[model samples]
Target: MWSYVGKKSNPRWLWHAIDHRSGKVLAYVFGRRKDEVFLQLKELLEPFGISRFYTDGWGAYERHLEALKHEVGKQNMQKIESKHINLRTRIKRLVRKTICFSKTIQMHDIVIGLFINRYEFEVSI
Candidate 1:
């Protein structure tokens, strides 16, 4: 899981992405939803070829997940939706902000990358 304090005024949104089959988080990026977020996501997945992508209604996925088949809409991507629920429950710091994040984007990348690694080896349900 990854997150960063945003714009000084917005609540921190922790972003996380996991493999549906293995339950390993592939990548996470934080900061106000922007092009850079998608860029980070792309960088994370570039090493591993992605056959398909499942995302929520968030428009960012639409703009970024152009190379692969993307399944949007709630009904189309229930697995990812359910995985997010687990992510929120397990990563309380991400959801509740008990820990204040560094204002810098670099810090966000480091922390988020660490969290993703922490869960990377786990098997999916």
Candidate 2:
């Protein structure tokens, strides 16, 4: 999903990877919705040894993930989609602070990363 820093035209995307079986967020990265950004998220997921990937036919996924390992369409993306809703609703409701209303990229990533690390992964960092 995308959010703007100061203006709508400058969108920063939150790329996520969800565990298919558990429906838990494995990792996420905040940056432009470009291949390099997606690559960063993919790199973070390397240790999981993910066998297959499901995406909404995003070009970056197709370009990086092999055809056999990658599946297009929203066939098994419901969990991830649900997570999106939760992030939007819960954050907006719970953190009506500078985090959600961030005007800078550094603050945006730091706050959201902290929240995700603490709540999503059950760890404090």
Candidate 3:
């Protein structure tokens, strides 16, 4: 999910990814959808030793995880897509898309990342 900040002269992109089962953020990258962003996401998830990954047909993800020998498949990707819906529904700032919210991509990504981490903990308890 993404939105533009009409009021801000500069716009940023925010990206977050979570483990659907745990509802925990495995990685979050704040930047343009470039090779560097892909690398950062991989770096963040390396500690988890993720052997399998499911994602939409995103070229960046293909470049990043494929090289790491992570199995990427299209089938059952709905689980991850569902996570996106869950995140958006819980984050009012994301739902509102107000002018003041998510002025920068990095900020939005970090916020969402933190929220996922917090939300997962809350859900378990």
Candidate 4:
């Protein structure tokens, strides 16, 4: 998902993966919506031994994930999408309005990361 630091024109994407069955975020990386960013998230997920990836038809996923492992369609992505909605609602910075915004990339990532870690993963930080 995309949010911005300082302004709407400067977009920073939150590239993340979720456990398909549990609908919980597994790993995430923050950067521009580029293949390198997605690759970083993929690297973070390597230890989990993920056998399948259900995702939107993003070009980065198409280029990186193998056909046998990746399934591209919204139908298979409902859980992740719902998680995104929950995030946008709970975190003001992620909402698609100017009411609240982060001023720095570091803060943007840190806040969102903390929220996910605390809320979804139940990690004590």
Candidate 5:
């Protein structure tokens, strides 16, 4: 998903992979919406042994993930999309046109990272 830091023009993308069965986040990365950033998320998911991937029709996913294991459509991606909604609700920084926003990229990632670790993963850190 796309979020802004410092200003509306400065965009950053949150890339995450979640397990369909458990509805648990496998890994996440924050960066520009580019192939390199997608590759970084993919690398993080390598250890999870993910066989199938359901995602939107993003060019990077098509280029990086195996064709046979990739499925593109909104229908199959409902869980992740719902997760995004919940994230935006809980993390005000993710909401568009909000007064609550991080002034720096470092702070943006740190706040979201803490939320995910505490709530999503049930980790104290």
Candidate 6:
């Protein structure tokens, strides 16, 4: 799944893949909302051996994942959507119209990445 960041005109997308059953974020990438970005996330998730993918009917998912392994609907994607809400509440940068936002693309990704790593994955910097 992808979420927007930065200014509207010069927005960046944060792409993340989560394990449906575990509700744990498996991998995340920061980039534009394009096929290349989704591909990068998919590549990162290769080691996990993902058998099924639940998404919000994005075109990229249709192109990338096999039809049988992919299911599109809000019902199956509730966990990830909930995570987005949690992230927006916890991370000010993710909230729309927030004054406290990263000025640069690199910083934006770095801050969110650090937060996810430290809090979500429990990895020490």
Q: Write the per-residue lDDT of candidate 6 for residues 1-125, one digit (tens) a residue.
A: 33344566777888888888889999999989899989999999999999998888879999999999998898887888888998899988788877887778888888889999998899987
Off by over 4 Å in 1: 1-8, 96-115, 122-125
- Enumerate residue pairs that collide in model 6: none
- Per-residue error for 108 in candidate 6, Å, reads 0.1
Candidates, ranked, lDDT: 5, 4, 6, 2, 3, 1
Q: Which stretches of candidate 3 lie over 4 Å from their true place?
A: 7-13, 20-23, 67-74, 96-100, 104-110, 121-125
Model 4 C-alpha lDDT per residue in residues 61-102, reported as the tens digit of each score: 999999999988888878878888999989989998767999
lDDT of 6: 0.85
CA lDDT of each candidate? 0.62, 0.81, 0.62, 0.90, 0.90, 0.85
- Candidate 5 lDDT, tens digit per residue, 8-83? 8999888888899888998999999999999999999988888999988989989998999999898888889888
lDDT of 6 at 21: 86
Q: Tell me the number of clashing residue pairs for each predicted model.
A: 1, 0, 2, 0, 0, 0
lDDT (Cα, 0-100) at 72 in candidate 3: 59
lDDT per residue as tens, model 1, 38-65: 7776788888787877776677787777
Best by TM-score: 5
Query: What is the TM-score of candidate 4?
Result: 0.95
lDDT of 3: 0.62
lDDT of 2 by residue, 17-102 (tens): 98999987899999998999989999999999999998897788888998999888877989988887777775652232334466
Tell me the TM-score of each prediction against the true structure. 0.62, 0.89, 0.65, 0.95, 0.96, 0.93
Q: In model 5, which runs have C-alpha deviations exceeding 4 angstroms?
A: none
Residue 95 lDDT (model 5): 97
In model 3, what is the error at residue 92, expressed in angstroms? Answer: 3.4
How well does candidate 3 match the true structure in TM-score terms? Answer: 0.65
**Alpha carbon deviation, residue 84, candidate 4 (Å):** 0.8
Candidate number that wins on TM-score, 1 or 2: 2
